[model samples]
Target: MSDRFELFLTCPKGLEGLLIEEAVGLGLEEAREHTSAVRGMADMETAYRLCLWSRLANRVLLVLKRFPMKDAEDLYHGVLDIEWAEHMVSDGSLAVEFSGHGSGIDNTHFGALKVKDAIVDKLRTPTGERPSIDKINPDLRIHLRLDRGEAILSLDLSGHSLHQRGYRLQQGAAPLKENLAAAILIRAGWPRIAAEGGALSDPMCGVGTFLVEGAMIAADMAPNLNRELWGFTTWLGHVPALWKKLHTEATERAAIGMNKPPLWIRGYEADPRLIQPARNNIERAGLSHWIKVYQGEVGTFEPRPDQNQKGLVICNPPYGERLGDEASLLYLYQNLGERLRQACMGWEAAVFTGAPDLGKRMGIRSHKQYSFWNGALPCKLLLIKVNPDQFVTGERRTPEQRQAEREQAAYDQAPAEPQERQYNKNGNPIKPAPAPVVEQARLSEGGQMFANRLQKNLKLLGKWAKREGVDCYRVYDADMPEYSMAIDLYHDWVHVQEYVAPKSIDPEKASARMFDALAAIPQALNIDKSRVVVKRRERQSGTKQYERQSAQGKFTEVSEGGVKLLVNLTDYLDTGLFLDHRPMRMRIQKEAAGKRFLNLYCYTATASVHAAKGGARSTTSVDLSKTYLDWARRNFSLNGFSDKNRLEQGDVMAWLEASRDEFDMIFIDPPTFSNSKRMEGIFDVQRDHVQLLDLAMARLAPGGVLYFSNNFRKFVLEDNLSERYAVEEISDKTIDPDFARNAKIHRAWKITAR
Candidate 1:
């Protein structure tokens, strides 16, 4: 304890320089800054002070040892060399955080486990007691770093990241980290402006992070005055009196700071839910008397007209990072720029945004740009002087121009005399050439947003499909929840299905979005409008799925895996082919060669077709729907499959129980629930799956395989069935590229006879 130890202070990246300045000001010697971190030598007193008073630091780590490690063996021995008893008892709970890779340590979890084992083994031999691992609310937190064949071990002195500040009970979406907010204010020179009696404002404050941090800085209060826990609280090394002195000093300084602040500090937010938390954070920080937060939009924001103000205005606007994020937020940034330009004509404004291009959309040129990192996203802070001479608001058109525009509009609207049409020489009345059709009124904003999402998903799934030779694929799922539709592509044709929207959404808005989305789909996929057929997909009962929506009886032949099948876009609720099950079909094709195949509840017999094409000795397809059975026959004939492929029109359960035929391989994928009049009784997959599997197992030969599949999201198998045979769930392998995003699209299992 007599030696001066090295202390490493970690902050968010791009704040290291600020932290370095902070450490130097705290009287810590040999201060140096690195990317996202800083280190300096300090005694116990200075270290305690940093934990209590420093606002920019995330963690204060005390170096214990550094050693060269050649392998996992070296790592174990290196940790074992230290006497952990000096820090924590054998029965205490602790947690180890490990980072970096070397010396046969590629997985961080495995590395942490090894470190835990070494410590446990070392302690248990002497005391006969092992320390338990506590991930949450641990008594001690140990940090381990393995870098380039070397390791640095440290004890976390602050316990949790110091940025927590202990005031935020709740936060809005994408709240800024507290310490990062403080660092930003420092970089924006808020403290200097406050010292000169300038106002501070956060127009887009969420959860009051910037406002609270700004008040703390302005009032000269320590950041950790309210923190009740520290890493050294439970350690065996006790220097309680020195720590008590530092905390007492910090508490007195905060009490004095709280009585002096009545500065013009405020925040504004649009969400009503965020208002209370902002107030709550201010109250917890003991700054409620000095700061006020209200609910309002940026468009109506302006400084108090009565008070002449020269201060700093800061905002962290949402930086759109998703496919449709930028399009929706263009007006938000533009409004921010206009608000600054027209209102605060003499103040300084700072905008922190991750999307720099959107910053340009503000129409106000920034005088200064400083680059900073918000977590991993690179961002910029734009500094501008709010003066009309420097940045103009670019307000609406002049009165003269408006008057001229109205006169021109009146002239264009007047009726005109009819003109005679000219014919080539026949003198017959000729009509003007047919007007060219305008590209279906460019998709609405909401529609373009849906199309953008579809295009993004297509670029990702299309590449995966090409690598796997998958032709029929899903191009768009319920990506935008508002649209609530699924679009699939089969060769050159597209099939669309709209999921019923919730009643809460306005019917008109929902209808408009659907219309725009439909109009936009053809353009997004580069297909003719006639090639897309739209339908409503929802829960069906009994014969609802079989009920024909249109009597067109239109059917087209689509080839999947070189096997042709008939698909009716207008006749039924579903296409004859289930595209998601393509991989399962290919599975049957790959493994059914030289094997007998049986497909139960087979709609259109796609699996039977694949099995027969793979050279199966015999294939039998059983289903209750005579319509699909006849369609199955057409699919068989189209693929040159005839004699060996038997299409039986009967209930699969009755067929399984009545027929004594044994098959080497069988595929069964039942509907989630069915109660058709043709069937003997209702079949619920979750309720009758056990009975279904038992019947199929009875008809299987010794060492035979049965593949049971279902789209029932809540399906659960009989656990005792595992005792009867070797059962393996191959659901992951059954999903194709298009349905990968939706893992619950379908589930498949492979069961084998013992």
Candidate 2:
């Protein structure tokens, strides 16, 4: 091998620039950047050093030769020209990896096989003792890259990817690769921060990757110092003396670095399950003295190192997969921002997220953003300076001004020491200090009015709800036009739905009023603020309303009509059980004795559970969503009504058509509009009601009753059906007291065979 060997260092996409700088710093000569790779020249010593020190590279390839090839034969001869005896023993094992197939080698597998064949043929001895293939741990690993018409063959000097620093055997579900984590730190300016002896913290640290990587960078430690294996360990061209010299120097440097006072590096994770694993990883990285992880939540995250200390707050909060997930994740990002504002003022923050929009919702402005890829998912690193000017609040102030106000507020809020008083000879004092007055947060006038309205409603409805044994009900529904929202009490939890204010309304005022209402809710309801779940409601079409709003996957059990049903308050717009349908479900329970029942569009099977509780012989529920069906199954199992209750997953129209059984009672409450992909075509409740009802009525036995309902305010039943079957409007009877204020909540009817 020559003194200067051509080297190609590969990395994850979007880290090409960072890797180029890092490679040049590690003695790589004349470095040039490529897509996901950096090509340069380095000697054997530099190659070994890069393998041990390059934090951003996935692999280090030492180029053997670059030959032009027009066909597979040329590729075979090109590989054959290399001296196989000098690289590996005749009985050694090797692995070949080929990329960019072309020039009559249409398949990379064929190209690799041809290269291997050429080497094996040349290395075969008189006794046919040839080198065998060892893909895992080989004596030699050759990489052939066919670019355009030229073949570039090289030897792999890094065995397993350099990212496998050997400390992260256990990680969270979505772990950033070690190299990628290092790249993020470098881009976030952790190196410079560490050089300044600044602190570091990760609010959502998963197994302490960032803390360990930051500690390594700050402590001047090589990333792979503890790694026991390397690609060139078994290669014939390996230089043991030169590698030993570089390794000893790196070891001494690390010792000297560790002797310095450790920087204040810490990590906090919300998941208690990850606390021990994070500690284990840090211990493995030999950074236990510098980094500490604690079980904490984002809402309560406080990185209190030393007084007056400020540093980087880096976290990789989860970017949820579904659109509905944004609802919950929005609050997560908000809580993170709130903590940053309250506890980490004057510090810097770096938020890495796949959802840039969610990052924007953090109530902070990013001064700079860099695009990177987490595997195939493109992500963004938002760099923020946690100062007063970067806050999304309408009021703008400089950091100095905010600091002054904070200091003044602290001085003013400090309790005055009790005045020293003269005492008599007895133990009792002549005079005692007056008790301190604790001031509470004052609500706005509109908020007070809203709170009074809620109290009045709760006073009137609480009695009725207790008498009726209702576990869930709507307490207030847009009672005041200014406060256009629906508040529901589910057990101890409060669910508030803020109807999107009209575009004509001044948004700032509306937001202020909503904030006031939110502030008054927990106080009025006498519950903790953490128990409140809020969602913004807007006009929805098709199946958009059914889409998940959060990924909580949490279901709360509630009782109605003597049966237990499950409701997921955070995951969807509708909380499984519809309060307006409570009376209808009770009505079904009243008339379901000894009769067969069927429910179409049986969301969560609440109505079916009521029927089963009413002693129905059997209950059949059908819906298109597997998620709802699963929920319905849980409801059935919760009430011990699983055996005779049939839960079918399919389009209700198709299921009804395919059914031949007869039912004595049927109830259907469907969406106003649906374009679900599972169904063959679109369904508008107003347009398709007749066909849906006709198909459903075909399965109705003689004298059976079918109750069909919908919430479309402008719906009108086909008049001709009244002539075929005796039909009567039953909307008035089904409206419960909770839904009485909004009488247009749903319309219902009873159709029976004439």
Candidate 3:
């Protein structure tokens, strides 16, 4: 017998059709769709199956009871009379969630509080034991929606939001939510395309969410197949036998379809930082074998043997909001269009962009442009088609032709050289007299003079580090014309480095002039002059052990100030220590009295010294480089720490697994990315953090506190982990005087066992 029940399935806007299809596939007859949500009716068993299988829905709400309401008082009374004892146990915990479109109850929190009061009052009146509220994860989730002066109350069948698909153990900056990715694919006609063996590709797949979603759609796999629990499992009216039957049927269906290979799904990204995340995400989605994620510049990407078959290329490239300037974005789009026209013949392309001006640079006439909302900003999805024969034989200039034309114009307008070149001997130009070597040496000496002056100014500021009660002080601003170099003086050491400026006129001259100016500072100050070192920043190549060792050993020297310091004067934007985090380091030092300390992602060990200074009994620091470990040991000795402290040069996860020692205080501050050869693999802050955090906590003593910090701006904590640990955001406290305004630079958390 079919048991009738009202069901609400919420989804992102423009994906209502996909939700309806998912509902119908779950045996829900006569499904109806809304703008950002869907409605339907199904038996209890079908609803359970929908929770397990529906990819597009965010939540599945089951209508438990309904009552008429005229005002707040009436609403409270109506809620109290719903026979709460029958559904919620007197000792069970509950949470009230509300969504209001119109009506007097505009504040969601106020409405939720009133609803909670009503439920508790009813339960207390009968059994004298009212349930408490648990905001993190509640056993019973009561949902209330108020629209047009009417209130609809329902039981949230999905305990947590359906977006917690359990497969995403890692995340990246501005990561598209899983459900949102599914909705986007559905809106892009993925289901229909999947049925016809249509391929999908994303040129700027940040972490391969779109590709994963497209693959899941092609494979007909249930979205919640990996999920551990659902809200329906804890509901009062849930039938265990019926739920099991529905899930088993879906599992059998998935097993039968698992043999089919996923559709051709490909993701390409220029940022090497995203490659690991894309690979991790694809593996997490169980589509690693079917999906191909490549690391390459999108402008230079060539089609593979299979991708040349002319499939669909769907791109969600940077819209200048999250990424940098609009002018550069336009150039990227222009190159993107050129690649499409050159390599992707007989293919259809779609670009989702929020910036319309940049979109115009693509040049290709879009066949269709659909408007959709990505969160709050309105975005346009443009569709363009390429005809294979027309693309090959079109009346367009060849790339070589364009280059030759530009070259000819440049040559015609070129200035003539001096007549000295015409006075040639033996068919060669006349050799000029060799300039005085002393004069050349004098010019180089003048460059060093300016660098010494800048170094002196930096040293003058270091004296105020302890006087100002500041952990660190910035002696130079990289943006300034005269002091374009950045000089950070930490409590233990000073970091001197050059900065990459925005483009300007006479760029080479400006750089050389800046170098000359920076070289004069150290000699001018005469304060521990040897400690002032120059570091040139550049892109890091593949990890090599000798290079790491050289970098570490290069800085091993004692300064005139009686401080043993390791100075890395070449390569890297900043010397290992970010002086702006000085305040947080001091705090760790102050709080480390008589405690065992574990520093995860310990770079250069500046913070470890502070902890040791505060009387830490034992300290264990783990990082990916033996070179960094050696430098860290030097820093500890500079602060008078002995060999009682240990430095393990290995992967943080591996060290965590092997170490049997427990730390009373643990600090985890991983780099955004470190490609080290000595390590088992690369370390990415956004991708491997959850596992790293779990491992760190395993070695933490009972009642120990872990201070975890990261520079990733858009980090989201896992929903399940919050239940086992108490987390408090301490980013505000971590800020120092030098970096007061840039909140995105770092975020710190205080984690403790519940």
The lDDT leader among the candidates is: 2
For model 3, what is the alpha-carbon lDDT of residue 258?
62
RMSD of each: 21.9, 16.3, 19.4
Ranking by TM-score: 2, 1, 3
* lDDT of every model, 2 decimals: 0.81, 0.86, 0.69
Off by over 4 Å in 2: 322-324, 395-754
Candidate 1 Cα errors over 4 Å, as ranges: 125-127, 321-324, 392-754
Model 2 Cα lDDT, one tens digit per residue, 1-754: 5889999999999999999999999999999999999999988989999999999999999999999999999999999999989889999999999999779888989999999999999999999899999999888999999999999999999988999999987898678898998999999999998898889999889799999999999999999999887889888899999999999999999999999999999897744557889999999998899999986556557986866888899989878642123444655677788788878988889999999998888788999999999999999999999887898964367789688778756754565433343222222233443533323357889988888899898878876776577768899999999999999998778989999999999999899999999988877776678888999989878877788889988877676656766778899987888888998999999999878899999988889878877867678899998778767756664553332267788998989888999999999898999988889999999999999999989999998999999989899999999988899999999988888899999999999988
CA shift at 148, candidate 2, in angstroms? 0.7
TM-scores for every candidate against the unseen true structure:
0.53, 0.60, 0.52
lDDT of 2 at 255: 96
TM-score leader: 2
Global CA lDDT computed for model 1: 0.81
lDDT at residue 440 of model 2 (Cα atoms): 37
Residue 195's lDDT in candidate 3: 83
